[model samples]
Structures are given as C-alpha cells and as structure tokens.
Target: MRTFAVLNQKGGVGKTTTAINLAHAMALRGHLVTAIDMDPQNHLTAGLGQETHPQVGIDEVLLAESDLQTTVIDARQNLQLVPAGTRLSEVEQGARGVKGGLLLANEIKKLERQDFVFIDCPPSSGILSMNAILAANEIIVPVSSDYLALHGMSRLMGILNHVEKRLHHKMTVWVALTRFHGRRRLANEVRDKLVNYFPGSVLKTPIREAVALAESPSYGQTIFEYQKRGNGSNDYSALADDLLHGRTR
Candidate 1:
C-alpha cells in the first residue's frame, strides 16, 4: 500500500480538497483507497458525504483504545474512511513520551488490501501532524499559487528533513499547486519556480481556482461528484493520473 499524507502548516490552501478528491478519483479508477482524517475539523469526513459518525476513529486508534479495522467506515465500493472528531485535539495534547510519533504508523500497518491511504493532516505542527508524517511513506504538500504559499513550502521542507533524520525513513515529497489561476503571471511564475527547483518532484497539473471546489464540501461531495464539468474535477483527475502512472513529464 502507498501511504500519503496531505499536509500544510498554512490553512486555506486546498489541502483537504486535494486529499478528498484524489482519494475519490483513485477509487473511481478501481484502486482500493482509505482516507484517514486526522484533522479535528473533520472536513474530509463531511466532504465524502458521511454524516454518520463511527464509534471509534483516529482518536481511539491513536490512544490505543481501538484499532483501525474497527473504526474504518465503508465510504464507497472502493473507498474506506476513518473519520475524526473534536476529541482529536485532546489526543494531540496528551500524546507524548509514548513514542506517539509512531502510533499512527503502527495503526496503519494493521490495515490490509488497500492500494492507497491518504492522511489528511491538520494545518499546524503538532503531535497529530508528527504522527501523520511518521506514518506516511510519501508526502503531498498542497500549496496555493500565491507568493506566500512558497514560503510555507520552504519551512515544511525543513521540518521534513528533521523528521526524516529522526524517523530513519526517507519520504518521497511532492508539491502540488492549488488555487491556481493559469491566467495570472504570478501563478505561472510560481509553478515554474517549483518545477525548476524541485525537478522531478513537482507534478505538472496545478489545481485551478474554482468555485466548485469550495462548494463541494458544503454539499457533502467531492469535485467529481459535485461538478464533473468544473475545473476542480478535471484537475484532480489529471492529478490522479499523474500519481498512478508516475508521468511527471
């Protein structure tokens, strides 16, 4: 199974949107995908149209009171979900001195038959985000097309380097541009700068700024289900294809 954590310390950058749509797109392609919502906000859960809360979720699993298999909800034919609740904040504050960084990694190992696992990390550095990075073999950092978004990437990379040294695991990191407007000169420049600096690490597709993406979660649907004709759907599908085929060029 390929484990990816969609993360950004900066909020409102389409991190959850990327996580949800990518999982949906992969499931649409017949890949067994499990989305683990590690954010206390639970936007990922609601976006997938899951109103029913599971008895146990990431909180219970991280606390070692419950396992992932028990908490996983069947989201779709090829998709599974591990929803998060407000108690997740309590777990984050208390998770310490117990090798908490590796808890999620241990829980993930118990899952079976999943082709892809996408972890929705919170928008801050904490025990929760640390556990996510430790668990994930791959990292997907979704950045807005704006200039300040570039600053966030530099900081995150430093953290990832520290994490790699501590965990003794090399994570494959990729940067995907979000909220991009191809018409904007700044957006095009930022994209090129990312590709130029990162080389093979940057995906070619940049998720364009779209109202459909913002409205989808409110309607409890992914972009593909919310508005197939929208740019959000097209961009995510392109992203899924890139991820599946490794067609960076």
Candidate 2:
C-alpha cells in the first residue's frame, strides 16, 4: 500500500481539503483507502463527516493503548478513517524521546488491509507531523498560488530533506497548486515558479478556486458528494489519476 502524507506546515493552505477529496477519489477508484487524521484539531476527521470515535482514535493508537484496526471507522464505501480527538494535542505534547517519532509507524505495521493511506498532518513541525513523516512513503503537498506559499515550500523542503536523511528513505513527493485562478497574472506566475522549481513533480491539473470546496466540509461531504459538476470535483478526480499514473512514476 502507498502511504501518502498530505502535509504543509503553513496553515490554511488546503491540506485537509486535499486529503479529504483525494482519499475519496482513491476510494472511488476501488482502492481500500484509510485517512489518518494526525492534526490535533481533527479537521480531517470532521471534514470526512465523522465525530471523534467514542472508543478509540489516533491518540489511543499512538499511545499504544489501541491498534489501528480497532480504532478505524468506516467513513465511506471503501474509505476508512482513524479520527483525531481533543486529546491529540496532549498526545502531541507527550511525544518525546526516541520512541515518539516512530509511534505512528509502529501502529501502522498492524494495518495490512489498506491499499492506499492518506495521512492528514497538522500545520506545524511537531511530533504529530513527525509521526506522519515516519509513517509515510509518499507525500502530497497542497499549496496555494502565492509568493508566501513558496516560502512555506522552502521550509517544508528542508524538513523533508532532514527526515529523508534520518529515515534513510527517499519519499515520492508531488505538488498540487490549490485556489488557482486561471486568469490571474500572479497565480500564473506562481504556477510557473512551481513548475520551474519542482519540474515533473507538479501536477498538471490545478484546483480552481471554488465555493463548493469550502462548502463541502461544512455539510460533511466530499466535493464529489456535495457538488458533482463543479470544477473542484473534476480537478480532484484528475489529481487522483495523476498520482496513480502520471507523476508518481
């Protein structure tokens, strides 16, 4: 199974949004998908239309009190979830020492059922993010089309480089430009910059700015379920195709 961490240290850059939609897209393709909500805020959990699992969540699993299979919730047809709870913040604080970084990875070894796993990381370089990195073999970075986003990229690049050296594994990364306005000069400029910097790793289909994407989560639905005909749906579907065939190779 391919484990992809949808991460960005910069907040409000559509990290959870991408993970929610992309995981659904993967499931639509008949892949057994599991989304791990590593963010303490549990945005991905709520975004996927789930409340905190009353019995167990990622916190319990990370603490070694529960296993991934026992905590996972069936979110959709082929999509499952390891939801996050309020205690995740406390768990993040306690994730210290050598064992902390590998906590999620150790739990993940027991999950032999999934075909694709998408981990939603918090927008900070902390223990939660560290766990995401340790558990993932691939990463999907969703960045808005702006200069500040590039600044975020620089920091993320450094973090990934450091993690790769530590783990001794080269992770496959792909960049997805979100909130793109095709007619805007600055948006086009940012896209060009990303293309030049990332080369073949930047996805061809950019997620256009759409009200539906923002509205979907409030309704506890993916764009496909909330607005089937919108640009968001088409773009995210295209992105999944890109990952499965185009850029991942």
Candidate 3:
C-alpha cells in the first residue's frame, strides 16, 4: 500500500477537498482506500457522509488507547475511514516530548493490505503534523492560483526537508494547483510559475475553481455523485487518473 499526506500549512487551499474526493475516487476505481483525518475539525468524517461518531478513531489509536484494527469504520463497500474526533488536540499533547514521534508509522503498518492511505493534516507544524510527515511515503501540496499561495508551498517544502532529515524518510513530493481559474491571466501566470519552480514535481491535472465542488460537501456527496458532467467531476477524475499513473510518469 502507498501512503500520502495531503498537507498545506495555509487554510482554504482545498487540502480537505482533495483528500475527500481522491479517497472516494480511488475507491470507485476498485482500490481499497482509507482516509485518516489528522485535523481536529473532523471534516473528513463529515465529507464521507458519516454523522455518528465511531467508538474508536485515530486519536485513540495514536495514543495507544485503541488498536488500529478496531479503529477503522467501513465508510463504503471499498472505502474505509479512520475517523477523527474533536479531542485530537488532547491526544497530540499527550504524546509530547516522546522519542520517535512517528506514532502514525507504527499504526499504519497494522493494516496489512490497502491500495492507498491519505492523511488530512492540520494547518500547523505541531506534533500532529509531524506524525503525518513521518508516516507518509509521499506528500501532495495543494496550492491555490494566487501569489500568496506560493509562499505556503515554499514553507511546506522546508518542513518536508526537516522530516526527511529527522525522521529519516525520503518523500516523493508533488505540487497540484487547486481552485484554478483558466480565464485569468494572473492565474495562468501563477500556474506557469509553479511549473517552472517545481519542474517535474508539478502535476498537469489542475482542479478548476467550480461552485459544484463547494456545494457538494453540504449534501455530503463528492462531485461525481453531485454532478457528473460538472468541471469539479471532470477535474477530480483527471486527478485520480494522474494519481494512479503517477509512479510511471
């Protein structure tokens, strides 16, 4: 199984949106996928249409209060969810000052086989984010088509560098442009600049800025189930295809 962390220190950059849709889209492609929300908000749980709180979640698993086997809930037929609780902050603080802070790496190994595991990291460089960085084999950064968003990408790269040195895990990193506006010249410039900046790290599939993507979450559905022909659906499909064949290209 391959593990990826959808992370960005900046908020409103479509990090949660990508994690939710990509997890569902991969499951649609007949892959066993699990999404773990490291964020305390528990947005990933709600995005998957789950309202009832699970008895055990990532917080308990990370704290060694629960095992990984019992922490997972079958979100769908092929998609599973390791739900996050509002008490994640307490769980993180509880692990403070411990050696080998990569608790997530140990928990993830218990799941014998799965196609992919996506982690939705919190928008900070706290202990929770450190565990995600240490656990992930790959990191995908979602940046908006704005100049200010570029700064977040650079900051995250620095953090990833630290993860590699301290955690001793070399990560395969990719940068994806999210909420892109095709008509704007500045957006086009930003996209081009990002490609120039990262070179091979840039994914060609850019998620267009679409209202359907924004509206679908309220009904607890992905873009595919919401409006199949919409831009949001098309872009996410492209993203899934790119993700599946990423190792090849």
Candidate 4:
C-alpha cells in the first residue's frame, strides 16, 4: 500500500480538504482506499458523508481497547474509514509514552487489506501527528499561495527530518501547491519558488482556488459528486491520479 499522511502544522491551508477530496477521487479511479481520520475534528469522516458515530474512532484503537478489524467502517464504494470522534481529545491526553505515538502505525501494519491508506493528520505537532508520521511511508504537504504559508514549510520539514534521524525512517516528502490562481502574479511566483525548491518532488497539477472545494464539505460530499464540472473537481482528480501512479517519481 502507498501509505501517505496529508499533513501541515498550519491549519486552514486545505489539509483536510485535500485529504477528503484526494481520497474520494482516488476511490473514483477504482482503487481500494482507507482514509484514517487522525484529527479530533473528524472532518474527513464527515466529508466522506459518514456520520461520526459516538464511541467509534481512532481513540478506541489507540487506547488498545478495540481490535483493528472492528474499527473500520465502510464509506462510499472502494473507500473505507477508521472514523474519528469527540473522544479523541481524551485519547490524546491519556496516551503518554513512546507506545502512544506508535499506536496507529502498529494497527495499520496488521491490516491485510487496502491498496492506499491516506491519514488525515491534525493541524498540530502533537502525538497524533507524530503517530501519522510514524505510520506513513510518505508525507504530502498541501500549501496555499500566500507568503505566510511559505514560512511554514521549514518547520514542517524540520519535524520530518527529526523523525527520519531519531526514528530511523526514510519517508519521502512531496509538496503540493493548493488554492492557486493562474491569473495572479504572486501565485505564479510562489509556484515557481515551490517547484524550484522542491524540484521533482512537486506535483505538476495545482489545485485552483475554487469555491466548490470550500462548499463541498457542507453538503457532506467530495468535489466529484458535489460539482463535477468545476476546476476543483478536475484538479483534485488529476492530483489523485498522480499520487496513485507515483507521478512524483
């Protein structure tokens, strides 16, 4: 399985949006995808059109109170989810040692099913995000076009580097430019800088700043089913294809 964690310490940069849409788009392409909602908010779960059932979430697995098999809930066709819940906050506060950070990774290794696993990480550098890094084989960073968003890349890279050195994991990193507008000069400049800095690791397709992406979650749907004709749908689908086929390579 191509396990990836869609993460960014900075919130509101479309991390959850990318995770929800990308997973949906990948499933649309006939791949069996399992999206793990590691965030306490359960946005990915709700975005996939599944209600956040109480007492059923990553908290159960992380607390070692539930079996991995019993935790998975089916979403749309070809997509499954290990949903998140309100209890995640309690799980975070309770789980304290090195074992806590490895909880998600251990559960993931035991899964005999799944072609792709996308982990939707919380917007903080907490134990949950650490677990996502430890569990994933690669990291997909979704960044906006603003200059302030540019400042966050170094901090994110620093965390990954620490994980690589201390944990002895060799996970790859891919930086994706999101909410890009071609008509804006600043957006173009940011894209150029990102590609220059990231080199071959940057994805070719950029997600346009589309209102459809922002509105889809409200309707409990992905862009594919929400507004199929919009640029948001098209770009995300292309990104899903590239990610599935290893276009970054």
Candidate 5:
C-alpha cells in the first residue's frame, strides 16, 4: 500500500478535511483506501459519517490492545476507516518509551490488500503524530492560504527534518494548498511563496475556499457526495489524480 500521513502541526489547516475527502476521492476511483484517524479529536471518524467514539480504533492498535484488522470498519463503498476511539488521548501517557513511537508503524506493516492508506494526524507534534509520521511513506502537508498557516508550515518542516535524522527514515513530502482564493492578493502571495520554497513538491491543484468543502463535514459527507459539481469536489478529484499519477516530486 502507498501509505500517506495527512499531517499539520497547526490546527484548522485542512488536515482532517483533506484526509477525509482525499481518501474518499481515491476510493471513488475504484482504489481500496483505508483512512486512519490518528487525531484524538476523532474529526476524521465523525467526518466520514462513522461513530466518533468507536470501541475499537487506531488507539487500540497503537496501544497494542487490539489488532489493526479487527478495528477496521467500512466507511464507504471502497473506503475503510479506523476511528480514533475515545481513549485515544491516553496513548501519549500510556504508551511511553521508544517502543510507543513504532507501534503504528508495526501495525501498518501487517495490513493487507489496501491500495492506499491515509493517516489523519493530530495538530500537535505529540506521540500520536509521531506514530503517524513514522508509519507512512509519504506526508501530505495541507497549507491554508494565510500567514499563520505559512508559519505553521515552517515549524512542520523543521519537525520533519528532525524526525528524518532521528529515525533515519526519509519520507516523500508533498504540500497541498488548501482554502486558496484566486481573487485575493494575500492568497496569491502565499501560493507564490510555497511554489518558490517547495517547487515541485507543491501540488498543482489548489483546493479553493468553497462552502461545500466546509459544509460537507457537518453533514457527514465528502465534497463529491455533498456537491459533486462544486469546486471542492473538482479540486479534490484532481488532487487524487495528481498523487495517483506521480505528478508531485
């Protein structure tokens, strides 16, 4: 499986949103996709229309209390989900030592028949986030069009560098510009800076700021299900195509 961790150190940067929609988008294309909610908040679980407080979830897998396969639940036709159970917050305190960080990575290696696995990481750079980073072969950083988001991106880059050195494992990183506004000068400026700094790592399709993108989560639906013809749906579809075709560096 081509595993990806949808990660961002800063909250409200479309990390969960991108994970939910992007996974579904790939599943829509007939690929078997599994989305793991590594965030304790359970946003990805709820957003996928699944019960927020599942008894068995990624937390159990990380804690070694349950196997990953047993916790898997169907979310969509081709999309499967591993919810972030209510006790997920305890993982940081419960699972200590170096072994804690490698739990998710070990569990992921045992997975079978999944074409894509997207892990939705927590906003903070905690043990949970570390597990996601270590498990995935690729990292998708969602950069919203704002100065604060740009600052967050810089912080995340530093964390990534540190992890790569400490763990001696390198991951392919891609930047997805989210909530972009073509009409706004600030948004355009942010895009320019990202393209300049990231070069080919920045994804070509920018997810435009759209009502459908924001509203879909509330209704427990992906953009395609909520508004298929909307900009949100179109952008995410293009994004799936981009990743599938190796359009990014």
Candidate 6:
C-alpha cells in the first residue's frame, strides 16, 4: 500500500478535510483506500459519519489491544476507516519511547492488499504524530492560505528534518494549499511563496475556500457526495489526479 500521513503541526489547516476527501476521492476512482484517524479529536471519524467512539480503533491498534483488520470499519464504498477511539488521548501517556513510535508502522504491515492508506494525524508533534510520521512513506502537509498558517511551516519543516535525520527514514513530502482564495492578494501571495519555497514539492491543485467543503462534514459526506459540481469537489478530484499521476509542481 502507498501510505500517506496527512499531517500538520498547526490545526485548522484542512488536514482532516484533506484526508477524508482525498482518500474518498481515490476510492471513487476504484482504489481500495483505508483512512486511519490518528488524531485524538476524532474529527476524521465524525467527518466520515462513522461512530466517534468505536470499541476498537487506531488507538487500540497502537496500544496493541486490537489488530488493524478487526478495527477497520467501512466508511464509504471503497474507503475503509479506523476510527479514533475514546482513549486515544491516553496513548501518549501509555505508549512511550521508540517502540511506541513504531507501533503504527508495525500495524501497517498487515494492510499489504490496500491500494492506499491515509493517516489523519494530530495537530501536535506528540507520540501519535510521531507514529504517523514513522509509518508513512509520504507526508502531505495542508498549508492554509493565511499568514499564521504559513508561518508555522518553518517549525514543521524543522520537525520533519529532525525526524528524517534521527530515524534515517526519508519520506516524499508534498505541500498542498488549502482554503485558498484566488482573488485575494494575501492568498495569492501565500501561494507564490509556497511555490517558490517548495518548488516541485507543491501540488498543482489548491483547495479553494468553499461552503460545500465545510458543510459536507456536518452531513457526514464528502464534497463529491454533497455537491459534485462545486469547486471543493473539483479541487479535490484534481488533487487525487495529481497524486495518482505523481504530478506535483
């Protein structure tokens, strides 16, 4: 499986939204996708219309209490989900050290048949995020079109660099602009800066600010299901295409 960690140290950057929609978009294309909610907030679980507090979830898998296969729940036709259980917050306290960091990586080995696995990582760089980083072969950081959001990139890059150097595990990192407003000067400036900084690492599609993108999660549906012709759906579909075809630029 091509494992991806949809991560961002700073919150509200459409991280979970990207994870939910991107995974579903790939599933729409007939690829078997499994999305794991590694965030303790359970946004990904609730966004996908799954039970927020599952008996077994990613927390259980990381805790070694349950296996991935048994914890998997059907969220969409070809998109399966592993909900973030109630005790997910306790994982940081429960699982410590390097062994804890590798838990998700070890569990991911069981999903050899899956076409894609997207992990919705937490906002903080805690044990949960560490596990996601260690497990994923690719890292997708959603950079919202705002000054504060863009400012956090340096710190996030530092963390990624430290992880790569310390663990000697290199991952293909991609930056995706989210909540972008093409007409706005600030948003356009942010896009220009990102493209200049990341070069070919930046994705071609920028997820534009849209009501449908925000409203879909409340209805327990993706943008494609909520409003197929909307900008949100179009942007995500293009994003799926970009990733599928390795067209980052």
Compare the candidates by lDDT and give the number of the best one: 6
Candidate 1 has a TM-score of 0.96
Task: Report the lDDT of model 1 for residue 56.
Answer: 72
Reference-based TM-score, model 5: 0.96
lDDT of 1: 0.89
lDDT (10s digit) by residue, model 2, range 167-187: 786798789999999999999
lDDT of 4 by residue, 1-249 (tens): 889999998877899999988888888888898999999988888887786465477788887778877878878899888888557887778877677888888999987768889999999988898889999998999988878777898788888998899889889898878989889999888888787777788777889999999999988898999999989998998898777666752
RMSD of every candidate to native, in Å, equals 1.3, 1.5, 1.7, 1.5, 1.4, 1.2
lDDT of each: 0.89, 0.88, 0.84, 0.85, 0.89, 0.90
Can you give the lDDT of residue 106 in candidate 3?
Answer: 86
- Candidate 1 lDDT for residue 224: 88
| Candidate 4 backbone clash number | 0
- Flag the better candidate by TM-score, 4 or 5: 5
TM-score of 2: 0.96
Q: Which runs of model 1 end up more than 4 angstroms from their true locations?
A: 52-54
Which digits, one per residue and each the tens of the lDDT, describe model 1 over residues 1-249?
A: 999999999988999999999999999999999999999988899888885654577898887787789888988789999999558988888888539788999989988889999999999999999999989999999988877888889899999998888768789998898999999999989888888777888887889999999999988888988898878899999998888777563
Q: 106-214, model 3: which lDDT tens digit per residue?
A: 8898887799999999998888888888788988899999988987788888878976887578989888789999899988998888888888787878899999988
Candidate 5 lDDT by residue in tens digits, 1-249: 899999998777788999999999999999999999998888898898897444598887777789999999988999999999878888987877667888899999988999999999988888898888889999999999999988888889999999899889799999998988999999999989988888888888899999888888988898999998979999999999888876763
lDDT of 6 at 17: 95
**What's the lDDT for candidate 6?**
0.90
Q: Model 3 — TM-score against the truth?
A: 0.95
Question: CA lDDT of 118 in candidate 3?
Answer: 94
Which pairs clash in model 3? none
Can you give the TM-score per candidate against the true fold?
A: 0.96, 0.96, 0.95, 0.95, 0.96, 0.97
Evaluated at residue 42, the lDDT of candidate 6 is: 85
CA displacement after TM-score superposition, residue 22 of candidate 6 (Å): 0.3
Candidate 6 positional error at 123, Å: 0.7
